[model samples]
Target: MSTGQGRLIIVVTVCVAMLLAILPMPDWARPFRPPWVTLVLIYWAIALPHRVGVGSGFVAGIVLDVLTGALLGQHALAMSVVVFIAIQLHQRIRVFPFWQQSLGILVLLIVEHLFGLWITGATRGTAPALQYWAGPFIGALLWPWTFVTLRKVRRHFKVT
Candidate 1:
């Protein structure tokens, strides 16, 4: 596919993934929610750093902030951090085995969660719930599946 077509596909994928992540789930399953949006963001950040930069991260974060009803900039800041790191490490991450790359993604999710906690503390005037950290923990657990599925989509659709 041409560059514009690839970019369009990425955008649509991210939008659908974000909607999936933000859709309300049962309370029990909610805590185990995979960071679908984050995963896609990281994937694109690593795969197309020039096209998907920190600004894209920031914008996506803002959209997530609005969707999740957290403090306005919380997700934005966390996503910014993830994108920055992904940009820096893209070369290495792209070459790593799938398992190793998942581990790196886990670390990035952890950092994003920590930032979320910090922001919640600042804006909500209360400590974050234990369930809050569960996001990243479960996100880590889901990384392999997410990576595999997204990879298949990319390959099938020639998104990259």
Candidate 2:
């Protein structure tokens, strides 16, 4: 794709992720909600490090903060950190098998969650329950499919 087209694709993907982040879920299912925006950010960070790195993550995360009415920079900070890691290891992790990639995704999600917990606690909040950690597990479980689908989308769009 041309540079403009590739940039458009990135914007569209991030917009879709932003939409998913705000889409409502059932109360019981809320705990299981995968961090859709983070997952998408990770995928792009890994697959298109040059085009989608910390800046992209930080912008997406700030949008997330606004959409979710979260602390101003909470998700921004966490996502910046997570995407930094993904970008750093993108080359090596891209060579790994699906299972390994999923494991890496799990770890990244956990890191994001921990950052969130720390920030929230610092501002005054109790420790979240074990179920609060379910998002990472669910996100990790969805990694293979998410990877394949996003790869296909990027390829179809000819995103660089």
Measured against the true structure, the TM-scores of the candidates, in listed sequence, are 0.91, 0.97
Segments of candidate 2 deviating more than 4 angstroms: none
| Model 1 per-residue lDDT tens digits across residues 1-160 | 8889988888887899889988889978887788888989998888778888999899999999899887788889999999999999999999998778878988999999889778777777788667877777777777777777777877888875
Q: Model 2 over residues 69-124: C-alpha lDDT tens digits? A: 98999999999999999999999999999999999999999999999899888886
Number of clashes recorded per candidate? 0, 0
Clashing pairs in 2: none
By lDDT, the best candidate is 2
